[model samples]
Target: MPSTEAPTTHDLQATARRVRRDIIRMTAAAQSGHPAGSLSCTDLLVAVYFGGILRHDPANPFWPERDRFVFSKGHATPAYYAVLAEAGYFPTDELLTFRTLGSRLQGHTVMGNPPGVEMSAGALGMGLSFSLGLALAARMDRAPHRVYCMLSDGDCNEGQTWEAAMASAHHRVDNLTAIVDYNHIQNDGFSDYTRYSGDGDRDRVGGWVLDSGYTVKGAHPGAGRGGPQGAGRLMVRAKGLDSSLRSE
Candidate 1:
């Protein structure tokens, strides 16, 4: 049985900081990676891994009853591996093998390589759909697990994201929570300025969620307040994105 006593928030924060440090170091070691995105997501990853929200056993990655987390933005492998190591999924030493040939820790996330990772990600906009399917299956089996998906704002432009948004809402997979790391920067430059220009607009990303019938909640106010620099932050939490599986 899982321990009923959760780790203290202070410990969680420490773990997240260590993870952030590791992200920089590992990415530097690998000589290539999305350090910005990884740093942005460290906090959320720590919260989920240490906050008692996920059902997982590092010793048993394929445990059927475990909760699922999909790193849709797979470039953030450094952040993910850090969390997995802290959670005991694999030896912390294995992190040094990242991005090397024959190492399980590829630039992107892959299942069956290391324990704790639920899916192979990094293609963008696909993790949510995959998570939606997992949530649906859990519901059918009368299980009480949840699916959490992490996304990138830059990737939100993908049409498939909106399509999956509609499908998740249509099926009412309330047990699934999708978090957007609204970093505002992409590989080329600032995402908002590049895509929509810097107007005094509400989160166009959040607007999409609301339009799709999900209850929207912001983690903070202002630009870049909810992304990687907001390290270890909770930007937003939505409910009823899946109305078919109502929570209340």
Candidate 2:
């Protein structure tokens, strides 16, 4: 389903600065959170929570019929919290207490810990399944809300990720949308070298995505139709294929 409300925009970079400041303060205070990935993924979160298609009211986070957002990129909690705070889900000042005992904001987002957190994500590739469940549940109940999941570069390498993607397509879950932040880096090494076969080899197995009934739009348009950028970022949705990819 398309956005029921018109999408809005902001000085995404400026908004990102505020989110980044909170990310910095959060990780700096905790002295134990992942910072690099947090920072790199902050811009995307800023765009989503502050500028893009997320239909949320920070004041009434759990508004029974609200669009759901999931940080499948769990380690980036600092940035996620910063966005939530900026959106008024919680006080920005509370960010400093991140990861402390009893703090709602943990290193990874835990369900029920934060006002708007949809999942307790920390392990890689699991969020897709979580988000899928939410979307499918909404479908069964015929709810109007949509589910958005943000994933990381490394997550694309996970078997579970692809499994969820395939299942999502098979189920015809039209309310689900998966956004990938391809900063080109995952734990231990660059994702291009570590995960994919490089040169778009994953395109073949991705046929399963199409076979499952997805329209199949990707950064690398699959099977010799690679875009100007290599394959890193992929956003697969329920209705059709729409890609905005990046280089290796």
Candidate 3:
């Protein structure tokens, strides 16, 4: 209930940049979190949090009518926390306590910590499934809220992602939209070498979802395919997507 007016593109972009700065500062304080992927997702987070797609109130984090967001890429909690703080979910001063003992901000996202965090995410490939369930519940209740899931490309290698993908589509959860942060890199090395063997199966994963009848969207800079009708397609960069439903 903060405000219904949509945030300006310039203001959203600036907020994202500030969130990026916070991510770096928090991770540096934590000394053991992922920065590359976190930085890469700053704009996407801002677009969702500030673009009016998400019905969130930092003061009322448990609002039933609010849109839900899942960070499947939980290692990027630093960036998530930054957005939550900027959105007034919590005191910005608490950001300094990131990763410290007894602090709510941990290396990964946890539900009990603070407001704005919707899921307990740390294990990979679980968020999409969780989001699918949330969307399904919303459908059952005829709720108007949507579910936004942010996943990492490398995490797609897990069978669970595909399982959830199939489920999301089979259930026809149109309210569920998934965004993958394809940074082309994972923990050990480049995702091509580590996961896909450079076969471009990374793109195939999204293709599979589309084939399964779920609308697909990519953050990759060069658009190669179209999503289903009413589906969004985006070409992403470090700053943001070329065309995104969440774009500022």
Candidate 4:
């Protein structure tokens, strides 16, 4: 194992800023990309890559024992690619090739086109299933690796998301972790999937619905609704795995 340890939250926060700046520059160059979604998840990505929470190595992208990160919320490639580049998965300059023809970086993520992208994300909700497969494989192989998939609130609109959730829960896939990025706003303007506590459904973000969109309490909400009201109540629940956060 490498002797490197995780960076402090402060340093990770700094790296996140650079990642955000990269998102701004990359999206501007692409001229057609999701900036809001990408910007919203910058710190979360940094927390994983540089926070030392995840075990991975950009130098050895295919290392079997390395942790896996599936960018399920692939539209956020600006942030994802920026993280990968900063993580040393590829050269930072390659980021400039974001969406041009023949460029490895597509508008959405493609597995083989880039060293860090684990799955080819095009549709809204396939990441959970794909990640479940990796987690199951790791279990069967007894490999000490974890697979983390990023999901989005928009993904909940798809039935496949539920199917994958059921499957993950059934198999007890502990190695898999899903993070949802519920910005309360999707391409369609606003996401109406809200969690109802006792009083009723909140029409706005609150509780666990953090400003950054990550669930506060626990990751159960396949729906990714938090009350901004606080992460404790009014949440979506995706059972099993390391819990569900916002979409990738």
Candidate 3: clashing pairs of residues: 219-236
lDDT by residue for model 3 over 1-248, one digit each (tens)?
A: 65777667677767877887898888887777888878777766776677665667778888888888888888888888888899998898999799899999988899847877888888888888888889789878999777778888766777898888766655555677777666677888865522323222233434332211111122232222233533322222221233442442
Question: Which portions of model 4 miss their true places by more than 4 Å?
Answer: 1-3, 194-248
Q: Quick one: ranking by TM-score, best first?
A: 3, 4, 1, 2
Candidate 2 weakest lDDT stretch, 10 residues: 239-248
Q: C-alpha displacement of 16 in model 2, angstroms?
A: 0.6
lDDT of model 2 at position 110: 88
Lowest summed-lDDT stretch of 10 residues in model 4?
A: 225-234
Q: Give the alpha carbon lDDT tens digit for every residue of 149-230 in model 4.
A: 7777777667887687667666655566566655566887866573323222432322222122332222224222212221
The residue-by-residue lDDT of candidate 1 on 1-248, one tens digit each, is 44445776567667777998888889889999889888776766776677666667777778787778888888889999988987888888888789999999999988867877778887877887787788789879998776777778755767777777777666655566666666676788865521332232333533222212212111123212122221121123222222321232
> Which ranges of candidate 2 are over 4 A from the true structure?
1-10, 193-248
RMSD of 3: 6.0
Q: Which number leads on TM-score?
A: 3
TM-score of each: 0.78, 0.75, 0.80, 0.78
Candidate 2 clashes between residue pairs 3 or more apart in a chain or in different chains: none
Can you tell me which runs of candidate 3 are displaced by over 4 Å?
Answer: 193-248
Instruction: State the displacement of the C-alpha of residue 137, model 4, in Å, after optimal TM-score superposition.
Output: 1.1
